[model samples]
Target chain A: MKTDMSIRMRTMLYGLMCVLLIPFVFPTWWMVTSSVKPISDIFAFPPDLLPRTYDWSTYQRVFELQPFAQQYWNSGYIALLVTAGTMIVSSLAGYAFARIRFPGADAIFMVVLLGLLIPAEVTIVPLFQMFNQWGMINTHWPLILVPVFGAPSVFSTFIMRQFFIALPIELEEAARVDGLGRFTIFRKIALPLAKPALSAVAIFTFLHSWNLFLEPIVFISTPQMFTLPQALTQFTDAYGGAMWNIQLAAATLTALPVLIVFIVAQKQFVEGLAHTGLKG
Target chain B: MANVTLSQIKKQYGNTPVIHGVDIEAADGEFVVLVGPSGCGKSTLLRMIAGLETISSGTLKIGDRIVNDLDPKDRDIAMVFQNYALYPHMTVETNMGFSLEHRGGTKTEIAERVKWAAEILDLSNLLKRYPRQLSGGQRQRVAMGRAIVRDPQVFLFDEPLSNLDAKLRVAMRAEIKNLHRKLKTTTIYVTHDQVEAMTMADKIVVMNAGEVSQVGAPLDLYDRPANRFVAGFIGSPSMNFIDGVVENGRFTAPGIDLETPSFTAGETSRQLICGIRPEHLVIGGEGISAEVSLVEPMGSETQVTFSLPEGTIVGVFRDRIAAKPGDILTLGVQTDGCHFFDPLTDLRVE
Candidate 1:
């Protein structure tokens, strides 16, 4: 009776899952198919599963319309910097909060977590003014610095704190006995054990900087300085008309690298996480 | 090997005093075991000695130096934690050699020391395996091996065998004893198991409620505990207590009477508690009559639970119990080995 019930439940779950998958899968499918289709045939009824005809020159138009390669580099390097910076900052703060015993440590950690409650959109006006005052406006500095040290990093810090709090404290004790000072133990012992949590933080921080459309549009005015997300919207003809083929072509390029990175590194870090649940 | 002295050591966590001021002296090359119930502050005192905990109000000296503020590594002690605390990422050889590397040992020196420890622990063949690849007993040996590679001035073990199966615990107990004999290190081990303490300790410190109850050799504590708590805690089946009053050269309770020695003669303290061990009671003898409540038989001996007029207590008889439950067995208590405590103070009386 239990097996019968589970079988029916599983079939129903799969049916619901397939139904839920269409909205997520179809848009990417449409975007890729429509990027190659002639702009006239894009909205053809009973949407094409495969492109009916390929106008391969649309890809060339993506680079011709804007410095697409430059924008791609801007997003890539900024995301990489943010990921690396957040990993270092958050892990150190998280380890100290979780393991160290100092005066008012808990109170200080609570104050840091308050950053997570505020979003970047709410503080953009002041941030823009500060960056403008420093002559960092229209540069990638605001994009790189804000997310690494600001509210987004707080979420990463919280993830790292939760992971470190569950970590076997005895390992640190053993390291201390093994002649390691605090920083050495953090680097050699705590950091290696924290690969899974750090990977998750990396994925979040990278994507945050990669898909930062509002910040780019607000801070950067020149097409040369625009990130990929902002530059995708720049493929417009005169009289404010949208260039559909070139825009889709640019958008696809922006999304594919992130998708491929997730596919490759996810297996490594996911399995590493399974090994951290040991009681010791 | 060096002596470790903890003088009036105290521990408090934000005004909550967990370990009250206590003093213990472990002579050089002595194996000291701190045995107590859980939460009795045995482990706390060991951590203080290891420099892992702050000595709130005392001087802790190792050999010739006052190391109260020294770090664990600087104190030159190696500890085996209860869960082994092996670095999960490193191989067994690296885990054992990790300390030597940090202390600026050359690669060859570290490797040679690790190899020596591995050979001693029978882990020479498994040096390349990670902790996840080892079984519980093997991991325990690796933890010991890590401590051995350092060859520190002192060794500390915090209930390191509690995670193993019973048969393995017995075997490891012998191994640790043999290791202590060979190394002759000033060691402090903490456990709640009295049997482990009795078998392995050169000197035993029994603690209760953040205070030291007694300190003596293992056989000395078993033969003559200093208090009711010590008497009750040190024995295997635990010593049974009969509460009563002594008057006119005899101690008497409900259906209980025993001749008193003249040492407490005319003493004002009449209220008494008598203790006798399970193995001291002999069945089918002329003494207190008890109806057998249950009978548990081992091939070497039989354990019988019974009720006298006062209360229920357990007894182990070398001979087989002939009768079933509800059978009357007159049991004898070896009074020469019996103990008396003053009920008010719970301290043993002469």
Candidate 2:
């Protein structure tokens, strides 16, 4: 039944795809190769595909600049906390909005969705003031609490609500007949079936928190508290002139963990977004 | 096992009423069927009895206690949904034992009960598989097994076999009937297929437009429907209706005249509908003549559609009818099978 293409046609198609992959793949390749190239050869005319000379010192200089290890750990743990916290808060809120019937539910949902329309730039001042009053101005609390409970989670809640709405109501009804309370039904029945949606939300929240730049720059000041994105900008000379090779090495380190996470979970990430369920 | 009684039970969504006040009774250990066309509120009524839907007014009693406001789990009634509704992630054994686990049954007790239900349903080998891995009929059996594992006071099925193919449906139908016979548990099953109702029910409740049209034994309802709806709804191919008037001990229409049954002798010159089943039309006898419009043959019988000046009618005959379209066939009415309905009220004229 499959109408497979001729070998020659397939070969040509693959060749075309390889050519098209250049713009996306070349930048990362350049960043990696340029990190080990001498500073003079980084912008050499007719750029070298492979480094003619290796300066392995740039990788070590990346750690020597700022508290790079500390920043890396901060970004890692903050993203982990944000992903976990967002999943719980959004799933509970989503299940309630999707299943529970109450007065003013639609009105409340509309208000929550309004959070999505407002950009983080608009609320940064009031948020900074609020965190300053709580003595959390230079701490990681603002980074963790804002994304988990604030505007960023609204989108995750929307995705979870949509997934729950598409679920069959008969399953819940059958659980009720089986002597389960509302919370028990949600835990034993609904939550387990919502794995795909939850993974999708986790990936989105983790990536968003990992690459966060503006929030760290605005709220954090000391080098020990700096996240990776903010620390990547800190690799500069005393005159504030950018350290080209060291910064590229640091950027490569920042991009490595996320690339590995994506490659490992890409299957679930795609399936989660498509919202396929276990058929019965 | 227990008896279920509905006393003027009603349901409405906000301002619009769907199920008008309905009253039905299923005696202890009885197998009752609620059969109707789609959107006839049959499933709604069954859900109300299952305690899934709140009663707007009146009382519902399962055995001796009023269950109108009780939660579905507290009512001790188990329900099988149309789609099976098996927890897709759980294995069949865990699905069958889920309710017992929630009820704080010991692990050994839960396992034993699940094993017994699985053995009864022929699902012992499939216990390790998830619902998605099983076939449709197997999933249906697991759903039934999940219900039977509870051993509740009452069993409710909402179009449980409607998702199967024709052959599997018939097989499951017989299996369900046999299960009912063995358990003798009070059961309320809702389906739109009248064949399931006719073949499986000890008592059939025929509903139309959210109201009970007739409630009786299978043959009793087929032999004597309470009104036009019941008469048409109960039988396959439906009953044929000929609008006519009784005059001079005969029924007369535009192109037909036939002798009236003895029951209609006193009601002379009255307008009514003559109801006859297809199997009741005798092929060769002294009766009104009709032109054969279409003829279809099964291995056992031939179904012939006849066109008269008044309207068209169908007849099923055991004889292999050789006549094709445009052929004229003489039709005779069996007087004993004749039913009279008042045309204005659409009610049987006793």
Candidate 3:
């Protein structure tokens, strides 16, 4: 009963799961294989899964076409800054919303939640004008500042608030009896136990900042100041046609590191996200 | 250790009142337990004393200071929560010593204190383990260890043993009572379990519907409950209440008549709620005739449920009853052991 049923069930389940995985797996497969294919074979009548002639030149052209290294650094540092900044700002606000009882706290939280409804796309035009007026149009300030203080961080704050709300109130009460102030309790007790939520928030915030497209194109004009997303778009012909090989190659470089990291720590990444009270 | 006084303590949420001007005073080193059914304001009163809840419109004095506005940190009290509330991230040692570290105690001092508490709780070997690794009983001991390490002015417990299994709760109850005896710290405990209040408290405060019904020793409240609420709430299986009328110095109901030397004027014509504790009813007494409905043998004592003239009543007896359901039996209510209360005010008339 056990062995025959197990064999049949296992094969059927594996087949179904693999079939369901096609959409997600295919895009990544296409991106990696096309990045390494010769320019002609990329659009051949029969698409080549393995390039007949490897075009290593596209990878070299990816770096040479623009200040891709500097743009990579721009994306890297801005993501780090946004992650760190969001962790601090959202955690403090989230703790207050969850644990503190200041006057009009619910009203203040509702006003903060208004940030989530006003998408960055809706506010981009005015934000561009505002940053341009401040002579900050070409810098990374808007990309970093807007996420840390605006809509993206609100979601992080919401995740963190939900997590903190689930924490046993007794721990804080015990801390109070132990003579720790509100800030001390938050720093020592609440934040340390909130590592799962913090990691989840960091993953989300970093990804959001790294993939910013419309904001970078609207705010940045200089190639030297361009982020990776803007730089990926720059890998095109002078007539504005996409150099698909070079773009794909650069996209591989831009996306591979995070993919590899996520794959390696997939257990933590998935579990951390699940523990943030987001899933049913 | 210091005396804690709550004067006209009231708790109201917006316009709705929860605790309505209840007063209680705990002498230095006294063990007080606030007990009642759920939503009876017992836990709320304890939280107010702990400074976790605002005292709405009352003055709370710990020792000599008016602590209405004081922060919980400034109130100098330790609390043991029902869930044990040990820091899940910290080891038992760190969980115990964390407060001392924040209070600017030296590493040596914190270590010494943690060592002392661990030894007292027999947690020395388990100090390095986190809270999640500990069993429920171990976590309860660790919670008590955290409370005692500080030696705070008052110790507050909110149903600290309710989460433990029945056997473990009994062991922890004795441990807590012994610990209170040794430390002699002013302690206020809250529980919905009557047994915990009866076993552990020097004074038991019985509350109902946001009001203090009675405050006395465990035996005092058990022997002489001030009102119908107290009489019914203070004992196991609860005191069986039978509605009856008072006339000719005897309370008469549907099927039974009980004598009450304590029934007074203005209560003669009024309907009264007559109460009889299960233990006070004598089985096989040839008094009031009853039919045995069920018999539950609890090793040393047997609990017999019988249908009286008024309603089904339960009686606990030390003697084993070989009676079966539908067996005709006679029972007697020891009038002295019974309590009487006016149904209108629900207050004791005797």
The top-ranked prediction according to DockQ is 2
Clash pairs detected, candidate 2: none
RMSD of each: 2.6, 2.2, 2.3
Query: How does candidate 3 fare on TM-score?
Result: 0.95
Query: Cα miss at A36, model 1 (Å)?
Result: 0.9
Best by TM-score: 2
Q: Give me the TM-scores of chain B across the candidates.
A: 0.97, 0.98, 0.96
On DockQ, the stronger of 1 and 3 is 1
Residue range B308-341, candidate 3, lDDT tens digits: 7657988999998899999988777875876878
Best candidate per lDDT, number? 2
What proportion of the true contacts does each candidate reproduce?
0.84, 0.95, 0.95
Model 1 stretches with alpha carbons more than 4 Å out: A1-11, A268-280, B260-269
For all candidates in order, the CA lDDT equals 0.88, 0.92, 0.88
Looking only at chain A, give the TM-score of model 2 against the true structure: 0.94
TM-score on B-chain, cand. 3: 0.96
**Residue pairs in collision within model 3:** B255-B309
